[model samples]
Target: MGLSNWPDICLGSLTPLLPEDFPIDEDHEFKPDNFYFLKGCVHFKNTAQILDMTNKVKKSRWRDFSQSFLRDVDNAAKKADEEQEKPKYEIKSCGEMMRTIKTMVDGQKGEKICELSMTFVSFDSSMVRFPDKEHSRHPLEICPVEAGSENKHECFVRHSIPYFWDMSSQFGTLYKCLNQKRVKIASICAFGFGKDAVLAIEGDQLDDVCALSTCIILLNGRDAMDH
Candidate 1:
């Protein structure tokens, strides 16, 4: 939530974070034809105002912001001492996550690549009652899949979140989680009027009902997914 350039609240706190729109899922999958993937590096920095130090650093604004986090033993001790009194200028600008993400997105370097699958499905029939299943026999649901049934839904990129909140001094693709082994996951699909029904197989139940305010956006195909 640091609000310097983007968030604009407190400026960069040097706290590594997921991309603003991370863990996001879209109703449609990214067209495999498009095939867009982002891979990059996570440069750590010791300072926050990367823009200000660009000239002194002799590197891109992003690099200064990320690589400024220092690893020198002496630098670490000094930073710990400054924790007693929080200063507006003195922030431990550790910039690994963002830097790595940027690099990955920029097609440079990464331990993992971020990719999304998008697709569009249209109803079999042009006009019909939404989700009523009044016409269950027909494929014309509210939204139509371009192809046929199966694989009609959209899915988005999903990955387990690393717990960097702790300053345990862990390093490199290292974060403890209940399920830390799973690298990437794809989830979230389907969109429609409040009353749309997805066919469940063999006694499985599928129903999603959100509050009026929340469903309002969903009904209109407005994505308000949280990262």
Candidate 2:
């Protein structure tokens, strides 16, 4: 997509914890100004076309939003049971689904600034990740919807990060305050593609989020093998 067609994105603010709600050193004096707040954001380079897909879907998650491809699979599964009355349910394989995602983003980028894809294992899903040459999958334990539902449903993106099996597990979550409420909107994690290092992010709106810091490191497996 051209710069003119790109959408405008803004940073979401981080929420502060109350003194009583958070643990603090009782002996030391609490400096409210220094300790009470944090702010962050992320921006894609002007020359690059960023396509980030993070897996934020819950296995037990209620079907909330109906996007294009998913709607097809969902509609077929809900049809009548009779053979003649039943709708033809051609299961959309996971690979096909990923291809669809790839196509949509790739179309927008006329030139290859960064044709990177990051996929992650969905939370609470029983599906296994077979080895793939270009995607990373991690199985997250099933978590209750209520475990952390204070955030708005719109605050997270449902796509999975496409990182292959060779990546590191250094990942963490990002929190922000939206409309007076505290919510987690993004997550950062690492993947090892062969000996190459890759970074993955999970969030509702990536462009608007701030980046405190970013560093990419490439490791030499030959040295480790010698040890």
Candidate 3:
């Protein structure tokens, strides 16, 4: 999805493996959620410097760098061709079937960072869950990878839902995900329009935000499609 002020972050299968007439499991008793259990990639335009930032960089410096980049994008009018030429990063992964799941994002320089991964912890679905909806008994566990590291689990975000009294208008509301120390990494506010949502991410948590937002967008898209 393209953000007006930031570089567009798109999620899709590089190529379709299923046939055009593949059956959609819309009538399943459990009802389908937005999470995907197939293979695909998360694409985004990024610079080498931003991707090279070390975890040791002070939070203030990281925030400044991220803000500076956003300012540059907002102030400059990028030509269509120039914008198309920006370096693209892709995180590829395989879902289910395989006992192991590992995904990484890589830039033109060929460096890699694990975007997210889920290994076979247990046969029970509730054992694995998303960070945003921690209160619910979700079946999948998505662990976030620390900056500059592949397959390293640093922390997970917790998602809480609105109270019953507020569910009418505020249904599907999402607070930002927090680290183990209760630090807010990113904030997402989704309105009733499904795909029409806003994401506010901090400078130091760009990578984490990117990974988290991918899942959110997929879930949003699923809702839009069903409705």
Candidate 4:
């Protein structure tokens, strides 16, 4: 989707989050002032950074080195300690179709923050659960605005009113719905490709956890398709 083809309302929604002079297109990257992506690590200004992926090669190297010197009993204890020290957020596959985003607390899986499910013929589904008295579950339905379009990058994320809804363009912008109104929240440039793939998040209108988790799920889905 090109900038000229974007609906006026969509453009209006992005004004507050993106600079007026910034170009919106697949080739033009979105760079938010506060958020940045670095080697699978998400860094927020003055906030805690999250590691998106654990290094498997580093783990293997450590195991090989330890086996050459450390005893089995000592090696096993060190491995357990390292696992507990790892980041809390994790994305685990439940089956061929479903995946869950979990947060660890006190060395145990704490909350299932979000769940994503794949579909054979339609857009995928994502459910965001709130840990509250009502235990609310919000469903985000992904639908393509242009029918039969091969650009897998463009889609609309529909959810309950006055809560969460999103419209994603091939240009990488994710607009959020607020009280039936749309506003830009995040953007992903060069999605699912190379080391240059970047994600930029802006403002505090939407929950950060939901925003990040959803972006990861979308990017992972695209990566899976490419592979």
TM-score of each: 0.13, 0.21, 0.30, 0.46
The ten-residue window of minimal lDDT in model 1 covers: 32-41
Cα lDDT, model 1, residue 107: 14
Highest lDDT: which candidate?
4
lDDT of 4 by residue, 1-227 (tens): 12333332211122222222232234333233333232232211111223322222222222212333123323433454477644344444433433333331211354555554433333334333444422223444333333244444333332232222222444355655443334555655442234323344554544545555555545444334433
Against the true structure, whose TM-score is highest?
4
What TM-score does structure 1 among the candidates reach?
0.13
Pick out the ten consecutive residues of candidate 2 with the lowest summed lDDT: 32-41
Model 4 C-alpha RMSD vs. true structure (Å) is 12.8
Please tell me which model should have the higher TM-score, number 1 or number 2. Answer: 2
Give each model's whole-structure lDDT. Answer: 0.19, 0.21, 0.27, 0.38
Q: Please give, for residues 1-227, the per-residue lDDT of candidate 3 as tens digits.
A: 11124221111224311111122223322211111111122121121111222221233422322555333332321331245432233444444542323334444554454334333332111112234432232322332222233222222222221100001132222222222112233333342223223233444333343434344323222122223
Clashing pairs in 3: 125-139, 128-140, 128-141, 129-140, 129-141, 132-159
lDDT of 3: 0.27
- Estimate the lDDT of model 2: 0.21
- Look at candidate 2 and tell me the lDDT of residue 76: 30
lDDT of 2 by residue, 128-223 (tens): 121332221232111112113332111211122111111122333333333333333333332222221112223223322111111110111111
Q: Deviation in angstroms for 22 in model 4? A: 19
